[model samples]
Target: MRIVLDGISRQMVDRKVKAGQVLAVPGPSGRRIYPTFQFAADGSLLPGLPAVLAALPTRDPWAVLNFLVNPDARLGGRTAVDLLRDGRVDEVVRAARHLDDQGA
Candidate 1:
């Protein structure tokens, strides 16, 4: 799921995106599409999410999104986002580094 930044608190979204704590992707129509995964049901950022984002292979939004949702062998066939929510930050970081090692 995705949300237009304006759908939420614009100021907070802008600040988070600027701080590299949130990912704002360019949508087909040239609007910013914020990934819904970045926010909890309560509209708060998931704990330790920014660190996971920082450890990702690339800053390209699509790449980041793919990484977050794709299942990984190292994660026992679970998506990185699942592991992150399960508090498996170190494992996620290692998996992310694996992507870098393969030059993804």
Candidate 2:
């Protein structure tokens, strides 16, 4: 992941995760594993990802991943990540904001 980030320091990555500016899921070995999907090919975060992350109902990384990958009715049966990849960030964020109301 560091290589993908172009050699960004661990501390910097940690800070980003802590700030809710990046997503890092826990691996089997208890290491935080950063998902590549959240980043563009150039290694920057997908646009508006930070806002979506912030709007998520849960801070749990696993829940966050599930929310992003699962199809949501609010998003017209598309996954949040899919909408994000398509640059429909406002729609994703809107869904995320209402996730808790739907008992997600």
Candidate 3:
């Protein structure tokens, strides 16, 4: 699931919070959609999520979003967000490094 800037905050979006990962991607008819996982229930970016985003192999929004949602063997078959929620930032960083090294 995704959300537009209006669904979150225009100011945060404009500031390119968390390396701009929280910003929405333009879609058909000029729609913008940000990955839902990038935001928490309190409407703040999840802690340490940007670190993984920073270490991503690609800066493309879709790719980075997919990486966050997909399961990783290094994460013990858990998604990046799951690890982050569990306070396993080290593992997430390692997973990001592995992806960077593998050119994924």
Candidate 4:
């Protein structure tokens, strides 16, 4: 499956996305194609990326940060997807934001 993200969602991705612009997927098998460069690629959508943050449990601006960086600190390729599926994304973001706010 493929998705196109835009608007505030686009900003969210831009803030945390890598140069490759890899969208967080459901599993490791989900291919991460660069939508900005290739519009019609297998496992990718058209125009732009999908609004993943919009689908989150809350509208916290920090959630996108947590999602993108959370996987950076983990070895498991599917860690980010797991966080989303389990509904712990918001909690993780909140905790991360709190830590950041406290300078910890």
The TM-scores of all predictions, comma-separated, are 0.80, 0.89, 0.76, 0.26
Worst-scoring 10-residue span by lDDT in model 3: 1-10
The C-alpha RMSD of each candidate to the native structure, in angstroms, is 3.2, 1.8, 3.5, 11.3
In the predicted model 3, the residue pairs found to clash are none
Query: In model 4, which residue pairs have backbone atoms overlapping below 3 Å?
Result: 4-49, 4-50, 5-49, 5-50
| Minimal lDDT window, size 10, model 4 | 41-50
Task: Supply candidate 3's per-residue lDDT for 67.
Answer: 70
lDDT of 1 by residue, 1-104 (tens): 54544356788788887777898888888888877876777677766778877777688888878888889777888988898888888888888767756533
TM-score of 1: 0.80
Please give the lDDT score for candidate 1.
0.77
The candidate maximizing lDDT is 2
Q: Which residue pairs show collisions in model 1?
A: none
1-104 per-residue lDDT for model 4 (tens digits): 43454323655554544432344423347643322322343324322223343333433334543543455343243343444445555544443334324332
lDDT of 2 by residue, 59-90 (tens): 99988998898999899888999999898999
All candidates' lDDT scores? 0.77, 0.87, 0.72, 0.40
For candidate 2, the C-alpha RMSD (Å) to the true structure equals 1.8
lDDT of 3 by residue, 56-96 (tens): 66777777777788997778889998999888888897788
> Model 3 clash tally?
0
Model 4, residue 84: displacement in angstroms? Answer: 1.8
**Candidate that scores best on TM-score:** 2
* Number of backbone clashes in candidate 4: 4
TM-score, cand. 4 vs. native: 0.26
